[model samples]
Target chain A: MATIEELNKDYSKENNILKKLTSPGGLKDKITQFQADLDLAVKDFKEKKKKKEYALSRNDRATADMLEKDLETIRKNVLDLRDKIQKASDFLANQQKIVDEKFEELSKDPEIKQKLDSILYKKYDRKKKAELNKKQQLETIKQIVDAHPNIQKWLKGIEGYEKSIRKCDKIIDKYKATPPSTPEEQKDLSDAIDEKNHSTKSLADRRSDLVDYFAKNHPEIDKNILENIHSYGNIDRQIAGCEKSINNYDKAMDNLSVAKDTNVVNQTSPSSLAPVPAQKPSWFHPIQRLKYSINEWRARRTQNIEPNPIEPNASAKSTFLEDVKLSKDEYNSEIVQKYLNEQYQENLHKVARQKGNDSNERGE
Target chain B: MENDFINITNEDLEKLSLEELADLKIELDDLVSKVNDMLKTCDDILNKDN
Candidate 1:
């Protein structure tokens, strides 16, 4: 067994690993801790159970309710913890599960078992080596910037978007004070705001620095692609990009005579909106037609009983019983008697003949 | 056994942070599980002798 100091040291090392890995996103540790707590709760539940069983045996109601309340709280906390941990795990990288494996071994081992200790130490040592260097961070920051060009145009678009957005907000506040906007009105407002704003997100303060080159230098791209590369700083360009299709639609809307005007303005096709008929499940009324003809053909061919139509069993039954039945009558009655008698007589005759020959030789 | 647990529960454990609570919970859970397991093992040893 390891000394108390040794055990404490192992525990401390595990704690340090956990502390460093503790990001708010990762619930791997939190859930592990919850599971540990849940187990204690189960133990407490068991203890409470023991008490309840004893009390019930003695007919004590008040004590049981008190224990039951404690148990209820524990159960609620356990359930809540499970939900929280699942949500947290979704957000975090699964790095904490590794830390948990080491923690479990170190905490559980009374003797500090050799294999577990070695695995725990190896994990600890590897983590110590992985501390990210300065050059790596700079490269990562650079890559983040270089990846998105639209991000620069986005930032410049922000100030331009601010005016329309503020107008939309004022409209929203007015709507809130009144009976509220209709769904169509709301959608129009949101779509109008979102069309420009969603693209401009790339230019927001923290991210804006990356795409500044678009706003800082160049009227557009290098002309190979011949695409108009606009700055995020230029929200006018962004509004125009969103408006281009809308402007075309508006022109189309205006060009329409009275009969065609609604179609152009609405832009949605009515034919595709109709729902298709639902097909009933096969089990409800087994389909009339066979999916494959091979099974039907084979059934027509064979003299033997038809194969069961249901899905094949995982394990087929053996033919050994049928084989045993076929062989039973022939081997049971006459054959055993004949075989035993013939063997006994042959041995008996040989022994008697040998004895008689020995006596005759002695007499001569 | 109830009294023993009552004493443990009353030992200022409620005031601790969730992380500290988890640590204490793991320790306690380990102890209880060990005891339950030990009880089963003792029963098995006695049965084996018979």
Candidate 2:
């Protein structure tokens, strides 16, 4: 058995070895420090969770979905309104062409030309003043008779067409208001517009057929009038209304704050959003135990040093003590398992690199 | 008792008497238990939060 002096020397030497393996800058200190940080993170996460401070709710999700649906419906309705207005304008242009043709046919007649000349009055000459005055009064009466028979049908058709166009303008005004939210409300508005459009289509088709009938009956009308037909009047106001309604819908969607429906709670802790963990976890628990044991052993040494303030007789201690050198082979044996694992991993890396090089050579 | 000092290198153990090594082994076992308790407590607290 070793004397107290020998035991103290061995203890000091063991402490030096332990300190080398486990002090602040050593591997054990790094591992324990990481574990301590992880433990602190766990505590922080728990405290935050208990308070429920960062709870995410799906309160406005349903409302947002419903609003989006309504906006989609509004977009489709605005496009339909534009298409309907375009078709109506095209129908109106076609009708205007037929009316112009009828007027042209009447104007081309010799009798109708003579009537316009008489109504407008020929250049008055001072030499034939009495003759012109008597003739002008008779000419006005003749002009009225000529106009009465011609252009009456053409004038009536245009008047009716203009009245229908005014009705379309009123319907367009109603369409620019707030669109329906529910399917039932949408159907009601849709059915009303469909009924109005169907009637308008019927009226246009009938009027166009009538114009065809008139042209057939009055074959003297020039065919060149067909070439003169072009789009007429302004649908610019209706186009602007459609654009404004679309913008209004877009603004409404933008203003809405829809809560995100996420399963975030199940995935990770809300406290995890603070920042990435500062410490790397050294997952081995045996290293942790070894670290604490080393600390306890060092603390005992400090306690021993504090009590023995007087210097020991170092010369007398040296006479009995032998200088010791810890073998490197023995140190290696202590961590043999770790050494073997490192070698195995190194071998695996070499094998993988060799395989890669062989495959590259094969490709060449 | 032998297994308790498994992490302590055999070369370091050769410097001490069997009694001293046994004492250190017991201390190490106590430390292992304390560390295990700490780790278990952390896990339990985290699980409770879930």
Candidate 3:
């Protein structure tokens, strides 16, 4: 088994490989080269098909067949490369994670923990500042809430009433539209209607109860403040924001304390175990390069960045399997259609408003 | 409904003592603050107005 130092060296090598594979220039070059090769093979196959050269002579037929084989090989190569690249990326990522976990383990040593104090302290201090700011904001919001007695109750009641009303309306609509095919269905509809009526009554009662409670409990409270209570909705939001910052502050402080308890181990201890080679990695095979290229091309395609064009021979016999090739026209038309639909909706609304205005003028 | 989610009907609010109300406010403020942070992050990602 490899020592921790050897493992660290392996991790670095894998990291470098991952970086090279993901680099835009290297990835793009490979994709462009693949496209160029595909375009040439496709062009040759189409030309022979256009002339009916396959039927004219056995030699032409052999050349056409050979071209078809080449294209298939290229497609397979692309697919295989894509699969390999994905596995390599996943492997490297896992390896990096292992290295990170090892460092975290080392950080738990009392010596290492003491060394990490400054870094951990910096994080904790930032969180403490944020906590103080949030506490101030929360206090402001709480003061507002305190000044407006029954404000929280009013907001909650109003919101609840609205939600309940919507649910009741849906039930009423469903009952009216469907009626009831069976006796059980009829009973359900009746129960739903009764429940809706009860909810409506409950909402009305809550509103009057709020008014009466405020009047009896706090007679000095202004009527205007009661009427415009909804304006203080932002207080609820601000209070929420403050609480989150406080929790984060607490969590960060806890982590800092844990770090303080850990030993201060030397960071360079693992590096000293193995001498890293200066030369390029010999394990980076040509096959890995091919995979990296295909994976990058796929990534670019997913992001809607147009790849270097591989010309399609429209008349050529398609021996290749159908792939979802990205087209600029189809993509552009989707965006155009969305814009046109919005304009159409706006025009409809405008026409209706104009007609209403004209009718109102005639009535006046 | 004793341990149900904090659906404070007028009756429930009325039954609460002054001390309980203060505790409830603190608890709610903490819960709301966490939710608000989560929502802020979502708004940032979507680039939408709150």
Q: Considering only N, C-alpha and C atoms within 3 Å, which residue pairs clash in candidate 1?
A: A152-A232, A153-A231, A153-A232, A154-A232, A155-A203, A156-A232, A156-A233, A157-A232
lDDT tens readout by residue for model 1, A1-364: 9999999887665444324334342223443444434444444555666786788787889887887677666556545545544444332322233334444544566554333333323322222222112122223333433576665444335434443454455456655676435897777666655754653453254234433443465323222211122222222322332333333333423432322434322433223332223334467422222212223433543455334332222211122123222234433435434533554565467667777887999999
Model 2: pairs clashing at backbone N, Cα or C within 3 Å: none
DockQ for the candidate 3 complex? Answer: 0.02
- Tell me, by lDDT, which candidate is best: 3
Misplaced by over 4 Å in model 3 are: A1-103, A106-120, A149-154, A158-364, B1-50
Over the stretch A51-119, how does candidate 2's per-residue lDDT look in tens digits? 333332344555555544544443343344334334333433443344335335545887764443222
* RMSD versus native structure for model 1: 36.6
CAPRI grade of model 2: incorrect
Clashes of each: 8, 0, 14
lDDT of 3 by residue, A1-364 (tens): 9999999877655334223433455432343333333333333344544444454465667666665565455445444444433433344344334433543654679786544543444444444454444445445444645676675666566546645565566566877898788998788778777776776786667656655655786554434334323224434544454565656645644655444443322321234222323333478654453344345544754587334332234311121112323244532445334533554565567667777887999999
Local distance difference test values of all predictions, in order: 0.40, 0.40, 0.46
Best by DockQ: 3
C-alpha lDDT (0 to 100) for residue A287 of candidate 1: 21
